[model samples]
Target chain A: MTVKLYRYLEDAAGRWPDKIAVQEVDGSFITYRELDRLSDRMRDRLVELGIRPGDRVGFWIRKSIDAVATIFGVLKAGAAYVPMDPTAPPTRNNYILADCGVAVIVIENRFEPMLIAEPSAQGAYPAILVIGGAGGGVHLRAMLDEKDRHAEAPSAVSAPVRPEDLAFVLYTSGSTGRPKGVQLSHLNAVSFVEWCAEIFALLPTDRFSSHAPFHFDLSVFDIFSAAKHGGTLVLIGEEVGKQPLELAHLIADLEITIWYSAPSILSLMAQFGELESRNFSSLRFVLFAGEVFPVAHLRSLVKYWPHPRYFNLYGPTETNVCTFYEVPTPIPEDRTEPMPIGKVCSHLEGILIDADGRAVEKGTEGELCIRGSGVTRGYWNLPEQSRKCFVEVAGATYYRTGDIAKEEPSGNLRYLGRSDRMIKKRGFRVELGEIEVCLYRHTGVREAAVVALADDTLGMRVHAHVVSKDGRTLSLIEMKTFCSEHIPIYMIPDRFSFHPSLPKTSTDKVDYQTLKFWSGG
Target chain B: MTHESSAMSIVKEFILDEFLPGEEPSRLTPTTALVSTGILDSLATLKLVTFLEQTFDIQVKAHEADEEHLNTLHTICELVDSKR
Candidate 1:
């Protein structure tokens, strides 16, 4: 199989040359032909900069036509792309760059600060490549100007990447207190896309709106599925993301047929009353994942747009999407609790395993393990951590998703919670250890334990209970500002409290449950 | 800003009916703190913004609806009036 993500895009161009492949909030449209031409030019420029086959490149740009073009261009140049969210802290961004050992860094000038905040690229890479300006290393705009826009797609490299070759690395937080890069291969991703398109009944006329960033795995479904079937992809601007009303208008005005995003985002839309009087006549599918969807909110959405089929997609980034369950029809009266995660997808196999690594019988709870085409290869550059989760079963590897779940007699999977201390906030993985490390780095902090607090206002907020060293007092503002430098802004504690000492268990381990009680969560 | 006209009553009812759900619309006032006061949380804020935009036929740019504008019912009413 070809290792290029662009093959799908190229096919779309052939099938729909005049169709709008992407539409920006500024009203600028990138037709398939233009996307092909621009990506060709960008590929040539990357080649000119010594980017070779198997080299890892990166993209830190916002959601735009350039982002879509650059993703295809990197694959066209035989390089895998790593993405950095611009909203994330500079330190986290720096760590990902160093860990991936990315050969080339491709980012717009506006986001240059995120890359340069650290001393240097500490991994197996060279200089950064700046787009839209100069002064970093190679000026992408200048290189593009010098390249041939009409250049033909480069011939397949002599060593064409196999289906198992790494296609991209997505860095996510782990329970071990560090970010791990999940290595997804071409086969792993394209297979998931094929399964999704088939199961969802995607068609060429489907106009999909992308709310998640390119870095998020959910974007894979949007981009790959759209490109595979020559479907229209309407790119929502950052401005639209902050204002739910603007996003609703974009969806309604564009006549989007499929909507896929985090449950929190959808809840925001429903809570805003945007779903009350709006008409989404063309919408036929609404897919949500990343966090649990409250059943009440789901009912409200169905009330307004009853035509669209609603599906709760459940999976970790390591396995793109292994399980899905459509909400029951005739809407049950007792759906106030979180909905069930349901059975495995058509191409995946799932089972619940207890602490002894033995399969638990029906109605028994255990960690959910999945084996499927969508399961990622493993973490990049961390063999030990990879070995811990990806276990060989029946001569194939199965990933331990760490989500505690139970298999009912009906084979439906119901979620229990995390087996570890990690939590999900705003759809980003968060580890208590990561927050504690940030707290320890502060000057006046002697010891700290970060606990997640459930707040009705914000789903979940991190609360840090700290003990000042030598009677030193640290103000909330100071601790917040200090944490801003060490960790991503989202992982920082929203509310801080100073404690003399933390409650400990009999084994001397930090009693997080007692901390949770103290937190009033 | 008196809840005198039936149009004002309708808008008030829409806010209470949609956001507060079963609560009486008469209890809600134009000066009420729809968001911070627990009347409307983040999700309700989204619904309120959408309600205002569609009912008034106006586009609410993302940045314009910051904390100051969305925090209270009076502020939201002021924002809607300005947009109108």
Candidate 2:
């Protein structure tokens, strides 16, 4: 059966026209009919702007009802949506816009100043649709006002959006310092969305809490799965999500039934949010991904919200949650190691291959490789990097997830850290090579090594060890200032140490193990 | 010491000892912007919040843990006093 991603929104709106489709933390709600009508107008406007099939549309807005509407509208217009984090450094946002060759950008007026100040903003796109006020671009309100002049909703476009067409592109850090966009097709997203609907057994009565940012892959399930099942999606704003206590209260106050976020956020709530005192009777499921939840913290979370079904999902953004493990009710006391990521989803297949390209036997450690409908098409423009990761294995194309894993006898996969320099900090996949490249941009830095120092609370903190040039000195203030200008605030190293020279391995490469140890010292 | 005065001292000591180790305690005052100045990032702010909750026996609501409430030494002391 042919499927388009927008069909989820259309089907839900048809089934439950008056149901609350999306809700913001500030008590704003959009009914299914309103969501449908607004997105239809947006789709007409996009088509009018010459956004054709297979074109890329970008969004740099915060989580709001308009953001959700824009996503569905882009899909309906037969173009893929690219979401850039509004809080990301302007440099990063501009790079993504240029890299994707976005045909149009939908941005909020508050973000217009940052966009205008970006050096890469000059002629980056042909058009910009400002969400709030008039700002050097087409005002979205004007477009909707023009549409309102017509008595009926605009007729659906005849643009052919096949299942294999691009749906959205999510950018993740690459080892080469430039962010690479992972392209997911309509089929890829729909497979996961359908599987989620089946597994979660969602209904119109369910209320889904969306805690991940719009740019994060976790939001894909939060948006599409809820839309597909006709469930109300309550968006937890970034500021609210940051406050563990506020987030806990939101869950309780909204009676959110299905909750999804990073383990670090849940850990904070369990530790500091007084979760035990809250009533989560309406909460039925708690889903976490991006990083391994420390078993101790997981146990504590269970103690507080024991009635909810807890699941640990595992996958990079490329595959959008291919594996999951349901935390057994009454977690065993002797469980010491981090929770297992469990078996592959019903719609996907996973394999563990050793260093020599041979499939390792069960219980042997090897790189996790996934091949299935959920796997993304590949990186947006980097063919070389895409070819390196997406390879043909036994005649089937597989995305080589650089993660190391071992399969248990019970068919569960135990995650052993990454095989490369990529680490998850605060549920964000960070490439150490990316930070090293930023450090090298400084003239006074000769060598730089970045490592992750694991923390129970923050998941992991980045520490940078650098070697100064022959006659230069480096200060924390200077280094931080330079990094903040080039990268996102989250990617900035938490701690910095300067040395005359870095420890080198026998192969003459920087000894990251030594740096990690020295960081402890 | 008065409750507010002791709370301020506790916050000051923690900031000096944890974030600005070995630095002169006089470097920071009640109105210094710890967050905007990059002295405390997201993780550090969380750490500071946990410290405040434990040391002052006050609950720093997640919303109150942001820059508006905890950016300065004085604001942090005020948050603690209000919660207490």
Candidate 3:
């Protein structure tokens, strides 16, 4: 089996040239043959521009066929694709670009607003290849059109890239600092994809619906896992997500066989009663991750599309996937509690370590650590940070997931809570300290402490406890508006509660645990 | 006034009960913002369309699933009645 992401596509193209590889929401479909040809053209263009293996190429575009092409094309050119969400705040985008040190960025002309909004992007990259057309001041599609498609592909692309060589750098949040890029090798991704295909029993006839954005790790399973089995990958637009009725219609219209997304989407669907309305006869598998799946939510889902096998996936972007549990038995009628993350996936070993870093006994809570091919190499450009999380054990390495979990008597793993202060809201990792820093940056704010408010509707909403100077009152809407300019929509605190002074621990650090209770859970 | 009768009323009641399971009796008005009030998320909006189509036996088109028809309880009930 090919270790590279592009190689998987090429293998599929050779095996099923005429088969549909990806179908977009606009009814535009691309065959495996077309995908290979287009990818080759992009690769030729990248090579002509002097981009070689080991060079970082940022795919800063919205979800579309073009984004997928950039990922495959980057891999084909022996380069690593760093996906940057177009909707991300300009500062965050700058942080990622600066941290990753990418010389070039592949973006859509429509998304040039990010470049226009950020003054730092003026000279951020040496070259910015706009996908569609010439937006402002950047290289246009002429570069792609002028490429010699007939030219032989680079045989000696990068030094025979080992499974340990960095494949892609996925940027994820740290508890008290800027997002760090996780360096995952081709071997790490390939192994995870292989296991994913097997666990789901994916068939060539399966049409996997893609909803998660490119930056998110969940989308990796949708793209690579489908390509691995020569299955069809359907790209659903953000509009489909914004309008769930359209999403329901698309599932039936596109004949989507495999469905995987965050639990929020499914919970929302179950809330609206859309699951019971349509005949999703084509769907065979459904998986949810990035958060704890509420039992009541999953039950509502099964009530409609009961035929598909339901699965709860657990892992961090640092490790593509470590454990998953298929809902083998039907959920009980009175399931008020959340479902467990269940067992580890095949080809991986999981251990729960307690506070003292010793293996915990069965049924005892501890930090979940994983050792396998799926564990990423380390964080890119952050050696000091990388050494902190990735630790050597018996001469081998394991990634500390920072998630608290417990091992059942039957060896199944149950997710408890986060060992760190980091929180997952609507699948986007938010650093409470980072939010606090943003709050402190406000001119009117003297000091701040951000806390999470538990709401069943929108997952976890942020509430900032602040002490403003001169007793000036700050409105929640005004603070949210200010945060919107500095952070992504998901990171914006839903509520702001003013305080005289933050409650501090003995060591003078903000008492987050006490503040969590003060935020009314 | 097509849905003013007992038979149609039960359908509306069922729609409210299934969609807003734990909603208060006092809040089950003819018009309530289901989409805006955190009652429906992206998936719930889709599931609502399918649920209406199956329960009312009408194929709801993708484009028609916009806020005009599915945003509010009254609008959804009206759309279902018209389609039926």
Candidate 4:
């Protein structure tokens, strides 16, 4: 239990001091020795800034090599890192920062305005470490550049941390008006990372692609897998990552041996990335998760890159990849149904139960619950929410997945549907109720209902229906601008419809089935 | 209006209709950074590309659909014209 997540990097540094640790594609590369030294210096700077053990440190900067080092640096300081989406609305970011009460924040200078909106009530704002030519704040470059500062760093060891200590917190959409932070301990994450290393047979020679943002749970696998095995992680920035062609080229040029990202990205690369002319022979394993990949697009990817083994990873942020499906190569032409989320991962336990919380027979659909090493300790600062997530069945507690699933005779779990209003839009989990909550807060809005519909290009689309308090039609433009200033852009409704009244069920709840039918979903 | 001006108008209208519903068309200038300014995420970019392809009767290549070419309104116009 003494071994925490940061030990992987420390151990890797010892084994492969000269090997490349983290690289920015077509930009710069840092060796394991440099990363170790930089992280140690970063740890020293954080400790000097009064970041104590178990303190949460916020990272609001874009993904870069320095950010990678900063992650380990915070870990070495015996603190948990909380990452906020740099592109999210200022209000959303401020809410998360205020909710977590982070001791310090690392941000790019350009976002000073966004941080300015934070309410000045929390006993002095978090100390800032700005990345770009720090103005009135400590320079992040000072932590990475070791020429003069390394001599100033203290040789004192940081406080000891246990495996159960907090490692990182990831915030996901909540049914309430605000987002909820999912707290994962070092044990929670280290166990999942170790399981991936074992299941994937990760090697020191493998080159992993860091496609997901650090705030996402998906990024945990990319960073720790490389650290644990002394592999190289090539960080892909947002600009290149958003461009299908550039990302496809990066996979080839960087010689990414292991490619892990959402199925949306893979589908994009397959559709418009000009994959026919691209080279993907270096890809040894390709993994996709978060949302279902349409079989057609997945088939096209298989056609072009038939060399790499494809895997479908399934899990929520609460449990890091509890189950996964290994796609059979050369998908049979007539296979219409998408592959099932395969057997539960060896490290975790899955249970399917009915609405009454009783175990269901095989082939009967029920909610999927997971328990074991990867299940998080709970949500940050929300004891009630945490306690509600667990239900004791037959004397063992399991975290409810909120997903409906059927157990096939072959032991694989077939994902049927969701029991809640949650949906994944472009790999980001969004709760429709959250959008409704935002709309309800709008002045003169009497009622709001939101639903997600499947889309060919965008993975899924959000549609919102609203009723005006005065029965006057609401301006679509004003509504959109209102939403843009409040919620993250991804959660914004693609289209808004006005109705004097919405259809309701006998229980007086808005009928989402009617909405979905009207949407032709 | 000339065909060029008409093309500009059409593109502006589409941008307002899809991405920036309430924003003034004049504010979205030719030099505005569409992709970098957080207006056009990957989903928005795909929709814009489809609009350009279907409306302009041209095909946008993979490399042409990058930030370098699609970041600015001017660059997007240039990309569409070149494809035509």
Candidate 5:
């Protein structure tokens, strides 16, 4: 068995040297042999730049074929790659880089000023490698070309990376006014990928759709599944997300055989894509996760594209697709409740524990806990927070997902929403407190509270309550602009309710319940 | 004002008031890249569509609500005028 993910790519390159491995929306592609050589060049470049094993490397560029090269190259150099969301506010990305101690980052020329000017960019700056355009950093496009290498094809290079070494770090919404990095090792992800290959029966002929950003865990299944199976990865630009019809056309046009993304996207295509007019016969498996699949949308999608098998995958960033439920064929029309999360994956052991951390009996509601090779090591640089979520029971360490569920008579685990204030907005996990923290950063704000407004169409919309400084009333537009500069655009509040003072609970904490009640649920 | 320019001003005013509340008014010209620059997300685009439907009595088809037609104030006005 391969010790790291890059080795799988090496394995694939050895078999099918001329086969396409990754492709962009423009239809440009890189074959397995070319991808291997390019990644080796990237590894050689990083090594020349002093990137060492266990170091953190980040990429602030958009999703493309070169971005895939960066991932494999970083791993080949025994470093973990931190993929940043380019659309996210640069301040947050800078903070993430500083927090994770990124030794280097791959960025485009246009983003250099923002990264340098941001307040979070203080301290020792990470070396930047520019692609596409000129920046103050070294131009990376030169080395990516095969012309710089020897005439003869170079064999695949393997680093001294161990199985337990960190492979990647995903920054998620943290409760404490910032984002937390969820670190996963090669062993942690390999187990999940192997399980996925076995469960879905992945084939080299399958063309997996890559829609999610590299930062999202959903991309894990998309990127690795193709490399592991020696299949082609089709990149879909995020711009198509707003144009559901275009998204539908891309899926059909790309001939995507294996599809995976948040259910909201599938719902969007079904609601407005006019999918019946298009062809989706290429899809063999369609996996949706990150939020509940509204039955109405699922039914409409099936009505249009029924060729693919549907699966409801459930897990947090800390646990990679821990449980899944294959949607039963011909969903009953009268069914109102969403489908259960189904059984845990074969590689993991899941248990339900009470408020006191004791295991609960069958058919009883409890917090879902997973202990296995799939569970990721907790947040980077956050020992206290990691200690809290990852607890030991009977010598095996389990990750507390903070999700409530119960085992049904059919032996399936049914999801019962979040046990805490975390909510899914457009299939992305968000902490209400994280928004409040951003609002409080503004000097114009005195007190701030955030609550979620659940909407069927967009998963959930954020509603914020604020009391401005010195009795001044803050305009909704000003708050929106301020929040947009500090947080992700998706995390922006849908509405702002100005208050002279916020109501408090009996314990003196801000009354989120009252605020939620005021939002009319 | 001419009908095209009148429609353009109304749409631009609505966008500034909604998506770019505190920004300078001169920034949102008729040719400004609203959708491409992410001044309008899907939800924001839907909101703009709702406002236009009620104000101008024009329906935006699912295909019409894409980057090509909805990317700028000029194209959006063209879409509104065409639908009308």
Candidate 6:
């Protein structure tokens, strides 16, 4: 086995040089050999740009063959890639760039204005490498063209990447209103990839759909597992992923064998899309994670597209994927119970522990703690926050996943809810406190509280209740406009309610339970 | 109100009720850019699309869901009018 992550691409190229490795919905395709060569040229360019081992590179490009090549090139150059959502608010992307101190950023022409507009005051902004179109930054195409003109193959001086070296830093919302970057090592990512490749029985003939964006950890499995197994990876763009009927058609047209995404997306497709009328003959495996799968929707999907094997995976961005549950044959038609998160993946051990660090009895719910090679190092640059989650227990390090779960007698794990106020809204993990902070940042707002309301479609919907200072009032449009400038759109509350004064506990803290009850959430 | 005005009213009401409850309807004009102003995200846009289809009895093609056609209230009204 290779120690570095990019070695999968190299090995795949050697084996299936002419095989189509990745294809976009618009019919653009990249063969294994072409992918390998492009990434090699990109790696050479990075070396020439003085990117050393351990340097952080940022990727804010759209989902394309070039984006994939850039990611592999960054990994090959022995640098960690920080992927920011291109559609995300530029302020949020700039915050991540400043936070990680990225040495360079790979971007497309469309996103140039967004990045150029938000100049980092902290001096952490890196040099930009434009993928297409004429831009002010270093044109990536020109660099590759220059390399091609030389007629000499770049030296094969590969960066010496070890298994323990950092592979990527994925930023997620922090409870403290700022985003925290989770540092994952090559070993951490590879262990999860190899386990998935084995568990799913992937083959070179299998065509996998990359439904999740690069920023989401789910995409790690989509991109790498396909590369590792030499399977064809179909890149599903954001626009197509949103259009349910279109996505359904593409799934059939491309003959995607492995389908992986958040359960909510699949549920949306089933609800709005003509899923029941469509033919999904080529699909063999359907995997979902990030949120609970509503049993009713799952049943409908199983009935509609009957060929695929169903699975429910559960994990946090901190740990790529620690637990997985395979849907049993003949799903109960009337079953209403929440599906079990099931067993831990190989080489990982999870325990339910109480607040005082004591193990909970079977059938009792407690915070889930995972300890193994899959556990990430910790949050980047936030030592205090890192210490709060990653702790030494019994001389072994364990990541305290804020989720509460109960251990079944059959050794399966049942997810309860978050021990903290963190909730998953539209398959994106959001901290209510973070939204409240954004709300309070407005001058007209005096007090604010954010809560998650359970929704049948969206895993959860955010609702914000506020008490204005004096007689001042703020409209929802104004509040949303203010928030859009500060936070990502997904974090914005779905509904807003105003109160004269917020209820408080005896301790003077905002009484959230009372708010939840009064609001009927 | 005529059919176009009623359709516009319904669209504005839905946006306000879901995204900005209790806000004045006048704040959102016929030219307000829902998509550009960050009011309708991917999921929210889908919800709006569903509402248009069910309420107006119009089919919203996947290609017509872009900002050019569905971003502003004017374009949305135009789309509904054209489909109807």
Model 6 C-alpha lDDT per residue in residues B1-84, reported as the tens digit of each score: 898889888988888788555678887888766775567866778888889999999998977876778887889999999997
Residue A474, candidate 5: C-alpha displacement in angstroms: 2.6
TM-score of chain B of 2: 0.93
Can you write out model 2's per-residue Cα lDDT over B1-84, one digit (the tens) per residue? 887888788888888778865455675778766765457876678889889888877776667878788878998887887876
Evaluated on chain B only, candidate 4 has a TM-score of 0.92
Which pairs clash in model 5? none
Total clashes for model 5: 0
Runs in model 3 lying further than 4 Å from the true structure? A116-125, A133-143, A146-160, B1-84
Per-residue accuracy of model 3 over A203-271 as CA lDDT, tens digit each:
889999898877888888999988888898898755466555567777877889898888777776666
Mark the 10 consecutive residues where model 4 chain A has the least summed lDDT.
Answer: A133-142
DockQ, per model, reads 0.07, 0.28, 0.11, 0.30, 0.25, 0.49
Q: Is model 5 an incorrect, acceptable, medium or high docking prediction?
A: acceptable
lDDT to native, each model = 0.74, 0.83, 0.73, 0.84, 0.83, 0.84
For model 1, residues A73-105, the per-residue Cα lDDT tens digits are 787777788988776677778788777777778
Pairs that collide in candidate 2 are: none
lDDT (Cα, 0-100) at A484 in candidate 5: 75
Q: Which one wins on DockQ?
A: 6
**For model 6, how does the per-residue alpha-carbon lDDT over A1-521 read when each residue is reduced to its tens digit?**
67689999999999999999988887878899988887888888787777889998998887878788888989999999999887677888988987888888877767777785234456544777766732211245565786568754455566899998999999988888988999999999998998897798899999999999988999999989999999999999876786777888899889999999988888878776788666789898999999888888887788788778989999999997899999975678889886999988996888888888777888999989998877898999998888899656677778999999998999999999998999876567788998998899998899999888777777777778998887556776778778877887778887678889899999999999988887786
**Residue A467 in candidate 2 has what lDDT?**
84
- Model 5: runs farther than 4 Å from truth? A117-125, A133-156, A470-473, B2-4, B12-40, B46-84
CAPRI class of candidate 4: acceptable
True-vs-predicted CA distance for residue A512, candidate 1, Å: 0.5
TM-score of each: 0.83, 0.90, 0.83, 0.90, 0.90, 0.93
- Pairs of residues clashing in candidate 6: none
Per-candidate clash tally: 6, 0, 12, 0, 0, 0
**Tens digit per residue, CA lDDT, model 2, A1-521:** 34788888888889999999998776778888888877888888888777889999999888878888888889999999999887677788988887888888888878877774222334544578777742212245455675557643456673578888999999988788998999999999999988887788988898999999988999999998888889999987766777777888889999999999989989888887789777999999999999989888888889888898999999999999999999997777788789899989999988888887778888999999999889987899888888989666677778899999999989899999888889987788899899889999998888899999778777888899888887355655557667877776668888888788889999998888899899993
The per-prediction CA RMSD against the true structure, in angstroms, equals: 7.6, 3.9, 7.4, 3.7, 4.1, 3.1
